[model samples]
Target: MNDSVKKRNMKVYIGKIKVMVFERGVCMTECDILIKGEKVEPVKEFVYLGSLFAYDGKHNTDIERRVNGALLAIMNSKSDSREARLAVHNGVLNPIYMYGSESWMWQKKHESGINAVAMPPLRSVWCLIKINIKTVMLESGMA
Candidate 1:
């Protein structure tokens, strides 16, 4: 509510900060929902999540980072077109792992050789759908 308080809040957005696994799901907990942004990051991890997780390291390695990227994409959504859908899909799925700790990102970018914006890419004819997910922290005032 004061000048110093606002400056502190903006600091959270001005840097590349890493959130632990526990803090992965809260986007609206620590700051106001001002200009949420998403962008893909390079993968670089080997944390085993097991088979049930279907996690492709080369692709889904940065699970946490991608999720943040996807969230940014959601904030940038404009309409329900093909590119829009891809952006949305990329945004939502960017952070999530399909198998367990593995995400479809690697598969599409590597083995499948498809860009995140190409339609009918891997999941078939079904276009991407945007889901308005409500966070637990959002209800409060801290994410």
Candidate 2:
């Protein structure tokens, strides 16, 4: 590893990167990898491309992170116009929730996590608008 760094004339910053090993089966073993004279600590999970991957094949961590990020995006978009805010909710938050969803064998907890993040913006949009009485009556079959 050190040799490759030296050969490429590249500098490695030890603090900025992590090294994790994903195991397939049950085995009690510890292995260390070295790069540029730095020891890499092994982790059970790692975040890559904004998604979390774990050795235990659980997506709780990933779901929590995505939900939290979506909520943060909504909270921080207070200065944007209504349409822009909706765009943030739809474009940014929805994609974050939907990304890698096909790979997930979703449980009730995962569905709840997704709903917890999705509902706030929708409720906000509904409350922010004034409903005309005629439209409301028509929708209620009174028109």
Candidate 3:
């Protein structure tokens, strides 16, 4: 390979390298990782392609991160119309929270967490106050 091409490839590889160890429910401490004589820093958890991965093989941190991201997106939405807000929830928020959900180990607490994140913005979209969850779900067509 050409010298310039080799240099560029090296720079790209070095800049993007990270080390993570997944122990199948065990949390491991950081350890040094070396590639081509360069030390790569180990991480307990890291975000990759907008999803969080941890050493303990749990989805709780990723779920929380996704919920927070969705909440932030909904709160920042500029639409005033209920239809538009609902559209944002369907189009933007759902994808944000549900990304990579198929691979997650399903659990009741995760469901509850997702619902807790989902309902408040929906209530605001429907101009609801002190209404019960069943009513909210029905009005939102989510029941």
Candidate 4:
């Protein structure tokens, strides 16, 4: 094997997420990013939101920043079809969802929450989902 080739292999891959799942003493794992790698954000926290959601943002600054923004958005709305959830990375639209995309944009009339999504071309994000009860109800039932 060439020296250069070996060095390259030793390098970490970017934009990857790593997941660890353990049950009944058996261990299962998956990942999307490598620590200290190019294109990958730092690991911030380790979280498991039941079967609904899961991610690590404890040690990752990028993850922490984004998550903080998301939480803020969720808090502000609090009671309607707010943002619900956010899928952001490096202030860009992250299309790839690691096994959880269902109901991300989910809306519940009685719910109160939103996602503080970030955008590109600078810290900007559109579409916060403003729900007008009058407008929503007008489109349904015998009016």
Candidate 4 runs further than 4 Å off: 1-92, 96-99, 103-105, 108-115, 119-143
> Tens-digit lDDT track for model 1 on 1-143?
24564777754442453322112232323323222353222222333443222212232344344444434444444444555545455544432433252333333344222223222221321333642223311321112
Models 1 onward score TM values of 0.20, 0.44, 0.55, 0.17
Over 100-140, each residue of candidate 3 has an lDDT whose tens digit, in order, gives 77756566777777777778788778776676887776766
User: Which candidate has the highest lDDT of all?
Assistant: 3
Candidate 2, lDDT over the whole model: 0.61
lDDT of 4 by residue, 34-136 (tens): 3453334433234432232223211112322444544454434435232332222321333321123342323352122212222220122223355444443
Give stretches of model 3 more than 4 Å off: 1-46, 60-79
Model 4 accuracy (lDDT, Cα): 0.32
**What's the best-to-worst order under TM-score?**
3, 2, 1, 4
Name the TM-score of candidate 3: 0.55
Give the distance in Å from residue 30's predicted Cα in candidate 4 to where it truly belongs. 30
Query: What do the candidate models score in CA lDDT, each in turn?
Result: 0.35, 0.61, 0.68, 0.32
Model 2 misses residue 43 by how many Å? 10
Model 4 scores a TM of 0.17
Clashes of 1: 16
